[model samples]
Target: MQNQGLLKELIQSLCCLPGVGPKSAQRMAFHLLQRNRDGGMQLSKMLARAVNEIGHCRECRTLTETELCEVCANPLRDAETLCVVESPADVWVIDQATTFKGKYFVLHGRLSPLDGIGPDQLGFELLEQRMATGQIKELILATNSTVEGQATAHFIGEVAGKFNIRATRIAHGVPMGGELEFIDSGTLAHAFNGRREF
Candidate 1:
C-alpha cells in the first residue's frame, strides 16, 4: 500500500487482467518496479504493440495481425473440415497437440445465459455463412465440457442439421472443467480421434 499513486494505479489495472487477483497484481507490480524495471518497459512496449496490431481473423475469428489467421491461410490444412472453438487460445492449444489439421471457426465465446451471452454473441451467423460456402463437410465442436460450453455446443448442433454439415463434438477424454490448453498431447489426440456425432 505504500507506493506512488502511479504504482498503485498500475497494480489496480493489472489486477483487472484475468487470473490476476489483487495479491498477484501487487507482487507483479513490485517485481516490475523494483527488480525488473527494464523488463517492465519491454513488457509495456510489447503489450502496446499487441493491442494495436492484433485483430480478429476474418475466417475463424482468431486473434491475428492480418485478415486471416495462419491456420486458415495455410494450404496444407484440410479444407473440408472446420473445427469450432470458443476462442483463439483454443486454437493455439489444439495446434500444440498437433492432432488437428483442419481450418478453424472460433466462436470467441459460449452461450452463457447467466453472463448474457447468447447464440448471436458467439457469431452463429458467421458460422452459417461459412457453412453456406458448401466446401466444409465436417463441423467439429471443440468447445469445453463446462455447462455453458455444453449448452453452446448443443445449440450449434441443433442448427448444424439445417445445413446438412456433419456436426461432431470432441470426446470427453478431457477432464470436466479442464480447458483444452491444459490437456496433455495424448489426451487431446485421443479426444480428437474419438470424436462423436453431436
Candidate 2:
C-alpha cells in the first residue's frame, strides 16, 4: 500500500530545510503529527509571516519589517563612522561582542564571482551614495576572515578611499579562550601584526 500523500509530502517538504536529511525530515514529520501538532502549526504560521513581511532595511540592508531598521533610525548612533559587515547575523554578533556605537552597512553577502554576486549585487552604489553625502568619515570593514570576505573588504576600502573616507579593518586574533596550539597560522599572523604596545 502507498503512504498517505499528505504525510509523505510533509516529510519531503521538511527536508528542504538546511541540515534536514530524509531521515531527520521523516522524524520531524512524525513527531509533529504524533505529539507537536499545535507547535507545528504555530511554526508554520510564523514562518509564513516572516517570509512575507520581513525585508531588507533601506539604509543598512539588515532584515527588518519596516523601511528603516532600529539601528539606522537611531539618532544617537555615530553617523561619522560606519561598520561594514557581510550579513545581519554579523551585525548581531558585533552588537553583542563589542561596544561599537557607530552605524552599520550590511553587504548581505560577499563577492562570489562563481555565485554571480558582485559590488552591484551587494549594494555598493547605495553605500557610495551614503559616503558621497560626506556624513561618514570612517569605515570599519568587519567582514569575515575568508578570502571572499577579505576581497569584499578590500573593494569597500577602495570605494571609501575614493570618497576620501578613512577605512579600517577589524582586528583578527585568537579568541579569549582559544589555545595557541588550536589557533590557525593565519590568525596567529594577524594577532602578531595587530599586537599593541604594552
Candidate 3:
C-alpha cells in the first residue's frame, strides 16, 4: 500500500489501460517484478517503439506503421466499400472473422457524452472527406449498440446521407450493450453478414 516513486509510477501508468484497475495494475507490476522481468522489459520496449512507429492511417484513421494500413494498401481489397468501426480493435475483430473484402475506417472512439466525447472526437470530419471522393459505394457502421455507439452510428448515417453513399449498420447479435471486441468470431461474422440499412 505504501508503493512510492518508480513502482507507484509503473502501477499508475498500467492503470491507464482500459479495464486495468489499481489492484490489477498492482498485480501486473508485481508479476513483472517477480516472474516476467524479461517479458516485461520487452513489453515496455515494444510499447515505446509502437508509440513512435504506429500512427493513424491517413485514409481510414486506423493505426498503422506507415501512411496507410494493410487493408488500405491491399490491391485485392475493395476500396469502394468501407466498414466504419469505433476503434482499431474492432477492425481487427472483424478481420479475424474472415473475408471482409472491403476496407475499414476506424473512429478510434465512440460518442460518449458523459465523458464529453462527440462526433468531432470520433473523426466524422475525416470520414466525410473520405466520402467526398465519391469512390466509396457503401459505408458499414459497425459501432456497438450501446447508447454512445448507437449515437455514433446515427451521426455517421447523417454524414453518409450528405454524400449519397449507402450506409448500413452491422446487426445486433452478441447482446445489447455488448462490445465487438468480446464477441466470438462466429457471432461477429454473422453480425457482419446480417447487417441492415440505417
TM-score of each: 0.81, 0.93, 0.75
Tens digits of per-residue lDDT for model 1, 100-168: 899999998899888888878888889999898899899899999788888888988878888889999
Decide which is better by TM-score, 1 or 3: 1
- Name model 2 segments beyond 4 Å from true: none
User: What does the lDDT come to for candidate 1?
Assistant: 0.89
| Model 2 clashing-pair count | 0
lDDT of 2 by residue, 107-185 (tens): 9899999999989999998999999999999999999989999999998999889989999998789999999999989
Model 3 CA deviation exceeding 4 Å by range:
1-9, 112-116, 173-198
Cα displacement (Å) at residue 22, model 1: 3.3
* Ten contiguous residues minimizing lDDT sum, candidate 1: 1-10
If both were scored by lDDT, which would come out higher, candidate 2 or candidate 3? 2
- Give per-residue CA lDDT, model 3, range 32-120, as digits (tens): 99999999999999999999999999888999899988889999999899999988999999999867899999888898888888778
Per-model clash counts, in order, read: 0, 0, 0
lDDT score, candidate 3, position 80: 91
